[model samples]
Target: MAKGWTFQSLIDEQMAVTAHCQTAPCHHRQVLDLVKLRDRFGPDAPAMEWDFKSKLKCSRCGGNKVGLIYTPDTSPTGYGKAKGG
Candidate 1:
């Protein structure tokens, strides 16, 4: 499902992604865009092609152990159901 997602891919596209904390009893998740990393995590945030997975953290758990899951652009992207019939 992740489709071998990597940092390079993120930098190259505006991917809808969810960052999940891997800490026990604290699976916090944050939905974000690839372009917002610098604004959210700061300009110095680590975005290495290989170490990308280790950069994300949960504000609730403060854990660096994170999981990056890919998400499809929905609603306006026409990938999700309309608001109403």
Candidate 2:
């Protein structure tokens, strides 16, 4: 886990967070809403903390073995490339 990565940090970086199910036979992934998370958990909530994982359950398999990933937005107007190469 990256140090000092709070929910606000992700928002500031315009990064998207996803929850991945690590349970065997259930590899489900879902993009999380940062605004909603920040609202629910507060902006200071630790983004990579284990306590956050305890609050999440895989919607597909109802499993607790979940992991988080932070990815920069890759839309044309977002963080990745420009309108054209």
Candidate 3:
């Protein structure tokens, strides 16, 4: 079973961009961007934290990027969605 997730926690974290960043030199910046994105979207509310956690490659580095991955309107179990669907 799964539970509903909200962006309250993420908002507290103050991330900017929601997605993971792969840029090596900017890894720290990536984190900052995520927080910034969150802040931009919701200065007091984030996009909502995913109920489940998943591992995704950094969009900039192409390697395993560690962090909380947010799935829109879906639970972590839904990560198996068909590719390019």
- Maximum-lDDT candidate: 2
Question: What's the CA RMSD for each of the models?
Answer: 5.5, 4.0, 12.1
Model 2: lDDT to the true structure: 0.84
lDDT of 2 at 83: 55
Q: Which parts of model 2 are misplaced by more than 4 Å?
A: 77-85
Give the alpha-carbon lDDT of every model.
Answer: 0.64, 0.84, 0.42
Taking the tens digit of each residue's C-alpha lDDT, what string does model 3 give over 3-49? Answer: 33334554444323345544566462233344444455543442333
**TM-score of model 1 relative to the true fold?**
0.56
Q: Score residue 5 of candidate 3 by CA lDDT.
A: 33
Candidate 3 CA-lDDT value: 0.42
Candidate 3 TM-score versus the reference: 0.25
lDDT tens per residue, model 1, 21-53: 889899988876666665666555555434577
Ranking by TM-score: 2, 1, 3
Error of 1 at 72 (Å): 1.2
User: Judged by TM-score relative to the true structure, which candidate is superior, 1 or 2?
Assistant: 2
